[model samples]
Target chain A: MNYPWPDIGTPLDQVATPMPVIDEDRLAANIARAQDYLDSHGKAFRPHIKTHKIAAIAHRQVEAGAIGINCQKVTEAEVFAAAGFDDILITYNILGAAKLARLKALNGRVPKLSVVADSETTVNGLDATFDADRPLTVLVECDTGGRRCGVQTPDAAAALAQRIAAAPGLRFAGLLTYPAAGGAAEVEAFIVGTMALLAEQGIDCPVRSNGGSPDLFSAHLVPSATEHRAGTYVYNDRSMVRAGHCTADDLAMHILATVVSRPAPDRAVLDCGSKALTSDLLGFTDYGAIEGYEGARIVSLSEEHAVVDLGGCAAGFPGIGAMVKVVPNHTCVVTNLFDRMVFHRDGIVTRVETVDARGTVW
Target chain B: MNYPWPDIGTPLDQVATPMPVIDEDRLAANIARAQDYLDSHGKAFRPHIKTHKIAAIAHRQVEAGAIGINCQKVTEAEVFAAAGFDDILITYNILGAAKLARLKALNGRVPKLSVVADSETTVNGLDATFDADRPLTVLVECDTGGRRCGVQTPDAAAALAQRIAAAPGLRFAGLLTYPAAGGAAEVEAFIVGTMALLAEQGIDCPVRSNGGSPDLFSAHLVPSATEHRAGTYVYNDRSMVRAGHCTADDLAMHILATVVSRPAPDRAVLDCGSKALTSDLLGFTDYGAIEGYEGARIVSLSEEHAVVDLGGCAAGFPGIGAMVKVVPNHTCVVTNLFDRMVFHRDGIVTRVETVDARGTVW
Candidate 1:
């Protein structure tokens, strides 16, 4: 498929509809704000690259004093590693022989590569893949009330760490948890307890990673975590705004779309739909929020059309051919949908970057 | 990003996890079934390419006796047209100058290219782009109880048809609609009224296109509709089965994923998540249905992890590293997420096809 990305100097109106755009000023501000906040709290910052999947954005984040980057998949980390990004942490359980072999290769390419494991099956796969010549760093993932991809208790986490320390080809690094929203207290308790248990077993725990965009500002509350990770902070979305983490002004990315059809006085359809703006409701009834159109709800979405209910709005409905900007419900999934994103400053196109790891889901 | 699509003849177990697999036997059977059903009703079958977006499958549909192809976007149509498809109908309102220029070029390439318009603004854009030397065929899009993008009334549809016929560079071909589910009676009434209005104005109405995968087998009920359009029938999904359009055995596409993490006794995480399997619930409580696991539910999804709750299941939970097949709630959105799809017959891989129009949203 051919993507007609606009040139560097093109204006936003002439670029195209149903295209993802990043505001350069807002993106820079977001990266700097998160880095400064984490730095003031004396925590290492590792921005997750799953949000943008662009090496340029990762470079910006690193330049803003991020300690490293966090990836979710082996193939996704391989893209950043090839682009000269070292000190990467993959916050996913690496299981199966095919993925373990690729993880070993990625570890060899980068200066420091680490992964998380919550079970003996995953740790065994990692231990069998690496050797003493180059040991792989493995972090024990604790539940911490997240109830997703983590051990139930701190005892299970410490047990996994002990097994990791005993393996010749693995190092028991520390504890990691992707906690539920507003669960910073539980996360700190889980990590602190696991660290105390590891100390009793004579295991040197180094990294304690905690992550969630919803509770990014509350990282200081979890004082035991040495490093903090976040992805959606770079692109504040409708979900973030609703969570009070960031206001609408801090949103860096917006889907530029055109009003292609207005079937009724109460309804208008945009060119962007599930293919451009994803179906991740993130608890919102609407797909996204349209800028300058308060009370307008994106009620439904087909493959390439978003139906907007214009009733109960103070503002008049946009006529056909008028362009509108939509702040997606979840910006990360929207980033994965497009091949390239147009970066702009003050409505002037700055650059167009290809999503390097757009479809590296495995 | 590098996608390690498996080689031909690779076993299903050898192929990478979190990859979309198409059962070739089921896919062929689906295409033949839809075509034969539509043929038996003496209605033309214009398969929508947005579901699969692969030229190979489109070729298969054409060979199975589809009259033409239906595309939702101009660039999407360009892909099938480049692959030797002559007759194409883009069922979208092609607005804006950038898209209209491309639409004119596409019309010049294909032998029979048509488009739908509901407003005078869209028709004027089309009329201004093309010349009378090579006129463009335009169909009036009627709402017909589907409140997405269409004229609200039959009178409005006939008015647009008259405007198209009066334009020097346009031809009022007929009427088109994407009706609501089980809206055959409403669709027939609307199209019949529009045709009568067009007949009173002495306008020639040759084509009446009615489409919806949920009402695929009921095409004969809408006797006025000359052709039928359905996309998901080619790859039946959970929603299709729930709608009683096809059985679960007719589902062709499945996400072959590996159990990556078994953190708890009653919970397991699959490698496929919102990025691989889409976040589109399609009114289902879970993301997808696990084959052979009757009571297991995919409770939640992250970007790269699907947390499955194995509670109350008659069958045992899948151990870590065990492979499972999942029928997605909606197959069309899943196809848009991946760069390539694997095809197999009887558990042996046959081919891998790149989604040609994967990110051609604009």
Candidate 2:
């Protein structure tokens, strides 16, 4: 039942292929760089742990001056809270009786636990499960151009805040918006308008939370935001590089896949595929970027094989059994694909961390 | 840590949302149907365990008369083999020293274990790891219009078979082809020609393997195929339905998701997203099909939310907290998403099984 990892000083060729690897140096640099940016901007940085799902990395972020951690699901937050991340924000509309009960239990355990809700049903569920003695803090999620989940307008946000404040077991804490990339102006306007409406209703909006990794730097533009939340900054990816957020050097995680089959000169198949790297294109045409193979692109992915077309490569491609590092299109999704991830320092194994919160989607 | 599911006979509304559920009767019917087709065709059936990844379901398939199981990776096969699946065919080119050693160990433990390779590198690795004392059987993967992994021509397949035959610790079993759907003609021509070529060289070809759920019925067209491998048919999905292989009633698995946010009249965001339903569109534009909402189309997906466009629904859509079942575009990828799947018979929970090979990509 034990899965083996290469020893610390073992060569890359000796390590397992199609395994997720994190460059320790690059990871430290990415974490420090992100924290520095938020510190200089005077924003409370709450890095989403959904990116890595590894407690060790989350602990590193906390040590690097992160104010809190953000999780997408209640079960995911439980993993972090159990690992001593006291302040956590579950940025999703949690419903269902079982989940609400779990959330209330998690809220009691964590020192600071906040949840976002765009509708009254979510608010009511939280209120029904939590007690007035240990009131749950609820944030009204706003549709600031995200067009996914949220109250449609600033007015709706204010209305939701009123309901949260009136609920016996809930406290209206803030206005939260996960805006679309480059939608800072809209986020600012929406939050400012909602806060004004809440103020008129004698409700104070203490936290104005805004997020989106693609718009991480431009977060300062939204002055109404008291804190900022973003994931994927801790381990930049191909989508981030294409979004001009970071360069290839900033990518800390890669799927170390070996060329298992070179059936023809043009076609070489890697052991990593949708099951290993994930199928989230995130606006990218190719599945991932093969490091050192400049022109080579991952043409397609089946469940367990990434078929790469070597026709586009200007330089020579790796032969069979030769390992290649693939920067996934979206790094966060790839983290959820595996049960454990290997950490490396200059191609040498450092640690193998279990993805503790993986499959915590419920 | 305890994820509660609704007890037997409990209403569907009471079960946790965003969970994968299986209809026991439908699953049994699907399995029996596929087995019957292969039985009538006089071909040995090898159901791929990658679709369900549950040991119990795999055992049922074997009990229903499957000759063996098909796994995509060595680690995946290990999970099945350890779970009492004595015969297995790993239809992948497994490389790396660690994996080769594991494969050899697994081969010794299992009564019948076979692997496929389309290149000399894979064959050499298998030959080096295994010995004449425990000789390994290898099938030459044929392209057969799949354009993913396989030797190009019959001559190449013949040459590879000759190489495998001459190897010190390898046995040339036959040919394997994961052909493009509806490409039975190509598979037949390639296999028959390769068998003829092998015959001219005094090499006997025992097994001609052709696969894919879409072409399962048409497998009889390939007269040279001794055994057929398929995965998705046991839990028929949207892709299989769209491919004209089955109907909605045949689908056994569905992602049970609750409407968490009704942000607008046209949009309803479900708790399930790419993390639950998967992003494997499998040529389908939408993420999944909501069972009763005929016009509803999954507009987009983030990590934690499935933004469903309710504009198309002729039947009234459910309000927030109301649960709905979603048929994922690709069931295999969806199976890899969740750790446990709930099985039900007559709307009553029967059992909850862990996805034994959920993250066995390596």
Candidate 3:
């Protein structure tokens, strides 16, 4: 696509630098790379739509050979499923009556509807909402390393899988794992130990799904992994850079914000603040990644302005009328902040895509 | 206006309870109360549009005796100004070349255009952007206890005001203060002292703007104040409640979320998270105000779900299916996150007002 801001030029005195800017080139390449990996590995690449939360990106993934999209929330799945994606796997434990009702409703529209369950309560909630005829496929989540939510051990896993199989409105699929950072060994140990036990019990184990972007490369190390779902790899951000996955230039999303104020000698402000980049440092040292600028801490943030304190230490301030590029600590949350993001290429902003699920909130 | 969801009944099952909830009765009372105060006060009420950023609320404000609306960013002002609010005071220092081009364009459309300047660079940036025929009015920001911006002394204020008045594309309108919490005396001292110094310089100061919801009641103490602009009174969040300005029930904006997971005993996860509530604690202790549950420390927040640890919990959680309301810690940031917030009347969702100025990043 032809870019709109082709004439913007290279930093002619900062036009407006606080809002995020999306680098379309890196994003396309990342999607292609992930697709290539999926193709070679004989594994289904069901990318999670939560990271982008934009239907445009989802459509792009489907075009890039993604089997489907994985959603962290039922509401998110509802959003993507509504956006014409035929298949979606809800990765989180889908509990509660209202959510189950929504999930049961979602099953008819979506070609494939699968969910992960860790405990009996969640399965019970799912059972109450779903019908026996339209049984929901259950993936037993094993707590390999990352201890957010899952059955603690292989025995706990087997018990849950058994419960799922025995349940009227449920069908046990297989083991699932959201791998711990670099804990491929743990994932391997858990899946190997559990599947063998299940085989001894004469239970069939077909699907083995795992996800999370931090250790996307480690998926190959995880034996018996039938599929992998990752989100952040598509639009690598500052967090990805911090995680040693991508470079700052490789980042696809840039908050195209304006430097609104220069409050003091060494102080500059961007129209983008916590509302734009968000204070989700995501375990990073710096507030966000501003490609060229260094020694600038995004010290203060109101709803609209991000006050950058240069500490009177810059070689020279980028003048008051400068447009600055800011990489949010957490790109996904920042994307959620805005209703639409202006897509730019070759120094021009041409298309503005609506974050249709911008604030679905429920 | 009719409400959505349950009016009165047993709490929702499997829901993450004590989330952000809007109290309809108190919300109406807050609007009327703030409107009444602004109406009765001598100063013109240009209730800051940054609070809600909703045109419906702006329309409501216009209906409720607001002379104009004070918006911090150009896009925010554009929303109300485009909606036919003839007068608008964009309080932030609108810097940058492209933004200036946009601001210059805006100056022609809006009948009255005013902005703030706390630095010399900003004054000049404004000078470069505006036209000579219709110079933009500059409000010299005074450091009234909020040490973020503004001139330190009255002489400094007089000097900048004189410079702004002398600048080709700028005219010093008056003084502005976003005071520290309960810094009315500081506003009074700065105004009186600055006015005295300006008089010594034989300069006429036209606008004296004092703002802040925490210090809204004390605004009358600044006798020469021309206007008062406050945003947070629209949604009296947990921070406001802690500031003693509002009770918990006075909150308006609530996150309508469902419980997705019940991982363990005394732990449930709600759909609303940092992407919704935002990380702006505003110095208030708890994450966000959960009406009936005071002890529920919003222990964890991801992009999409708020993991509330009800371990040493007080009020029991609502059921999984319940749609609980959450009074966010900082309402302003919360407003910036979502595209639309469903207004409720008597617990029923009434209207889906567009956040017209949303994602107007640059």
Candidate 4:
């Protein structure tokens, strides 16, 4: 599997198509902007590495003033930990013996490790794997209208936090919520109610984590949050653009695809399909947005072909062998599709980095 | 990145969840049935390797009477060629210099290599890459109705065939079409009209390749077809079952996921998210079908969480830490999401094969 790696300064057309190309300038601007916003709000920014899944990018984020990295799985956190990141927070209910063992090993390797638990079973699992010698911080995840993966009410969150504190080897860290976008007030209320219950139980809550890239700018509105976690804000996508979180110029990642087939006047197919661009619609009507083709719409996708309807384009469709850049609907899922991505500066290849934490879902 | 590979005879519960498992018996039956259908129709079966992307399974298809394997990309074909497969058909309009060079090298390694071309640019590109000493066969792709990638009309198909025949170092093999399923009449008419036009130009059409998994059993209805290509029929999925192509019992691939969180009585989230199960809707209302949970529907997916509404289950909802099997909406795309899959017999692990061409999309 010897792929053709482009030269240090080779242009994009000279390289391969249907591959991810990260704009270095755009990446730096995005990182600085997000960090600046959080810093001005007097909150800690713990960026989620699950979006980029690259150790180099994670290191850069940390160097740019990120407090730590947030991972959704133990294996993903392990990759960043092995890459020399000392502080990590895994935001999932990790279960099973195989994973618990890995979590224990990861806890030993990192100086600070935090996990989330919304149920008693998950708290017990974490307690069984760790002890006072190697304490593991557990955060109670509250469902603030996200309708997924969290306790239903504030009372449930306080109860879980109390259980974590009662269990040996487990320290109740704080409250975390991945609330629905535009639900900042709900998150604030949820955090306040949960902290009140914790106060009555004589428990001290140190951290309040609120996360979502869509409402990142409004994070300050939630007064109870001390830390914010986000992944997609680093590389805004078509969904982010539509949500008004970022504009097209802020998109750092794009799929460089060649127009391989022009079957008819209205139809042109690109080499990038589900395997390259991903199928996460993310509420977008189309799969992606072509840079210059304002009117073009990606109608459908097979396993290896992305069929674009060129009838809507104001400019004529591209000819065969012409390369085009596509902004995928979801950047995080697109990052997981490829094993490696090329970072470019002004269309010149600079470096190629592997997605180290990709496919480590367990 | 050392993953936990289950030992031989390891139970499903002992292995990590959210991984693909292939049932050996069902796989064998699927292969036998599809091959039998094509054999009885007097058509050569060239199973597409894009579905499984494993050399071991491609070898089994060849052993079960497949003439060759159909690949969607040159890099994918190279993986099969390195694994001792000599005859291959890459059903993509390969463009760009980097890819053409790789194609030439692959042609030199394989005894028989054919590709599809619907435009003159593709034909000339193929001609420029090889000479008469190392000729390449080209198939004129006809747009019968699939509307993805092919020449618009039979006249265009014949014209492209004529151009391919006149080009040096290229031989016009025959006519090919990836028509809409149940489009036997359209395929027959397109092939007949193209053959008539080619005959007027004093040309011979040797192979007529018709492909689709849904209408595989109806392949014989199109008498002009000499060969049929299909990939998903070997590992039927939710889409195939909904298409009336196969039953749930015919499905051979299933994702083994663990119920990691029970946020509420009506909602249970599995570890298999879009990263593991894929977000390919494929016209299905739900993401996947949970075995024995007749009423359950996968409501949504995050990067590491598959939130399923468990209110519809006839059987009781799976408790936290419970292992469940899920049949994905599109099995082929789901196969590309994983690096390796476990093969099992009667719930016992037998072999674990890497998806050799998993991300070889050039």
Each candidate's chain B TM-score? 0.98, 0.97, 0.89, 0.98
The most accurate candidate by DockQ is 1
Candidate 1, which segments miss by more than 4 Å at Cα? none
Full-model lDDT, candidate 4: 0.89
Output the worst ten-in-a-row residue range by lDDT, candidate 2 chain B. Answer: B1-10
In model 2, which residue pairs have backbone atoms overlapping below 3 Å?
A: none
In the range B146-217, model 2's lDDT, one tens digit per residue, is 888999999999999999999878989999999974377788899989999999999999999999888898
Which sequence of candidate numbers ranks them by TM-score, best first? 1, 4, 2, 3
Q: What overall lDDT, based on C-alpha atoms, would model 3 receive against the true structure?
A: 0.73
Comparing 1 and 4 by lDDT, which wins? 1
Give the runs in model 2 whose Cα sits over 4 Å from its true position.
Answer: B5-10
DockQ of each: 0.84, 0.77, 0.40, 0.83
Residues B1-362, model 4: lDDT tens digits: 77776888998778898888999999999999999988987999999988899999999999999999999998899989999998899998988778889999899999999999989999889989879988899899888999999998888998889899998899999988898743799899999999999999999999999998987888999999999999998888999988898999999999999998888888999999999888999888678989988799998998889989988873488799999999999888878877888999888999999999998888
Categorize the docking of model 1: high
- Rank by DockQ, descending? 1, 4, 2, 3
- Candidate 3 share of real interface contacts: 0.47
DockQ preference between candidates 1 and 3, better one: 1
Q: Name the docking class for model 3.
A: acceptable
Arranged by lDDT, best first: 1, 4, 2, 3
For candidate 1, write residues B1-362 as lDDT tens digits. 56678999999998898998999999999999999999999999999999999999999999999999999999999999999999999999999988999999898999999999999999999989988988999999989888899998899999999999999999889999999743789999999998899899999999999998887898999999999999999999999998888999999999999998887778889999999888898899899999999789998998999989989672587788899999999999999999888999999999999899898888
Which candidate, 2 or 4, would have the higher lDDT against the true structure? 4
